[model samples]
Target: AQSVTQPDARVTVSEGASLQLRCKYSSSVTPYLFWYVQYPRQGLQLLLKYYSGDPVVQGVNGFEAEFSKSNSSFHLRKASVHWSDSAVYFCAGQNTGGADRLTFGKGTQLIIQP
Candidate 1:
């Protein structure tokens, strides 16, 4: 079985500071990795994903992720974070066996400090 783990349950950072959200996964083989964000009252939105080819994929709003098969990690990074960037972020994994299912992490709540 495949699974995702987010070691940090919550993180606080000052505005304009760089941010990195850690994610680790366990699977039989390298699975498709994804990062999603959820606003206050909005549904989860895809930030970025990695299936193959490039290890680093660009995401929306200055977000990008690097997939590492060696470490079985797909961490998300932001050059600079804003107040509006505060939200709950989730990392998910889908097996390449053609299943439409995705295993999600517990999620990390990002808080911005003034």
Candidate 2:
């Protein structure tokens, strides 16, 4: 089974500060990792993904993630964040050999301080 865990339930950062959201995954085999963001009352939008090739992949809005097989982690990072970046972030994983369904974490709510 593939599962994702986001230890932090909520994160607060200054408007211009850097941000990092933690994610850990477990699977029998290599898994497809993803980070999805959900704005207020809006559907989830993919922030980044990692399947193969590079361990680090760039995403929309200057977001990026690094995958580590040894650690079973795919953590999202941003150099600087804005108020609009405040949202709920979900860490998801899909077993390459299994169904197309994605197993997601509980979610981490991002709050930007003024």
Candidate 3:
């Protein structure tokens, strides 16, 4: 079985500050790592994904993540976040085959302080 752990359940950041969200995963084989962001009452949007090749992957909205095989971790980072960036962030993993469903962490709620 595959699973993911998000250390922090919530994070608060003032506007214009950098943000880093941690994610740890456990899988039998190389997992397809992904970061998704969700606005209130909205579906999740793909932030970034690390399938293979490069260890680092970039996503929309100035977000990026680095995949560490040894540590089994994929962390999301944003250089500067705006008020609009305040949303729920989720760390997800999928098996190599598409048959398996995506496993997501509880999620990290981001609160932006004006």
Q: In TM-score terms, which candidate is top? A: 2
**What are the clash counts of all predictions, listed in order?**
0, 0, 0
lDDT on C-alpha atoms for all candidate structures: 0.91, 0.91, 0.89
Over 4 Å off, model 2: none
Put down candidate 2 lDDT per residue, 23-88, tens digits, no spaces: 999864356899999999999999999999999999999999999999999999999999999999
Residue 92 of model 2, lDDT score = 91
Better by lDDT, candidate 3 or 1: 1
Report the C-alpha lDDT of model 1 over 39-103, residue by residue, as the tens digit: 99999999999989999999999999999988989999999999999999999988556667788
Rank by lDDT, highest first: 2, 1, 3
Give the worst 10-residue stretch by lDDT in candidate 3. 94-103
RMSD of 2: 1.6
Candidate 3 TM-score, true structure as reference = 0.91
